[model samples]
Target: MAKTQLNVRVDEDTARAARERALERGMSVNRYIEELVRQDTGEAGHTFVEAAADFMKQYESVFAEEFGAAHEGRGEGSREHRNEGRR
Candidate 1:
């Protein structure tokens, strides 16, 4: 895989905070930023589907209470119908 360099400019306060936190964790500022980017990339961390599933699992009880039974497959009120009003 090819690697590229990225340069970002952050506010003084944010940079200070990042540097302090990185030092506390015994990691360099670059490594801390790299870990964050890797997590967001999904391919290296959790895929979007896996992340969504984990989120739903964590909030299943709250969602069930608010929205009632969770729909399985394409039931009566599926998200597939979301674009029906667009046309």
Candidate 2:
């Protein structure tokens, strides 16, 4: 694929950390940044929510057996109560 150069200005500390991360991952800073962009744009596949949902689906039977029918009676009020102090 044809690629274009992108210039981004970040703080020196951020740049240093990014370089260290790239080295740890055995990739160049350019490739590391490309991966970050890809993940941010959802081009890397299986976002966090999607993956979590998939995992839940896969373990639905086990979770249901462990938790039993208790979850069904829980209403939206429980969520509202839980978030009461946050915002």
Candidate 3:
């Protein structure tokens, strides 16, 4: 994609908040703002939930065969269960 530079102005408090948010995400303020715009405009790519569902659907049988015993009684929501480790 072709990149273009945009100049924006905001109050000091807003700029500081942007910087803090960007820092927390380990991204530069420019990239953080870019992502915010993408999400707001619904141009963002597939979300983690969508991707994770796809992955679980693809490997569900394999996981069942291997980990079925361990997952016994945990119910059918293994997808949510598997995501616990990420947190």
lDDT of each: 0.81, 0.88, 0.89
What is the clash tally of candidate 3? 0
State the lDDT at 18 in candidate 1.
90
**Superposition error at 49 for model 1 (Å):** 13
Model 2: runs farther than 4 Å from truth?
46-87
What TM-score should be assigned to candidate 3? 0.54
Model 3 alpha-carbon drift over 4 Å, by segment = 45-87
For all predicted structures, in order, the TM-scores are 0.45, 0.52, 0.54
lDDT of 3 at 66: 79
Better by lDDT, candidate 2 or 1: 2
Clashing residue pair totals per candidate (backbone < 3 A): 0, 0, 0
Error of 3 at 27 (Å): 0.2
lDDT of the structure predicted as candidate 3: 0.89
**Residue pair clashes in candidate 3:** none
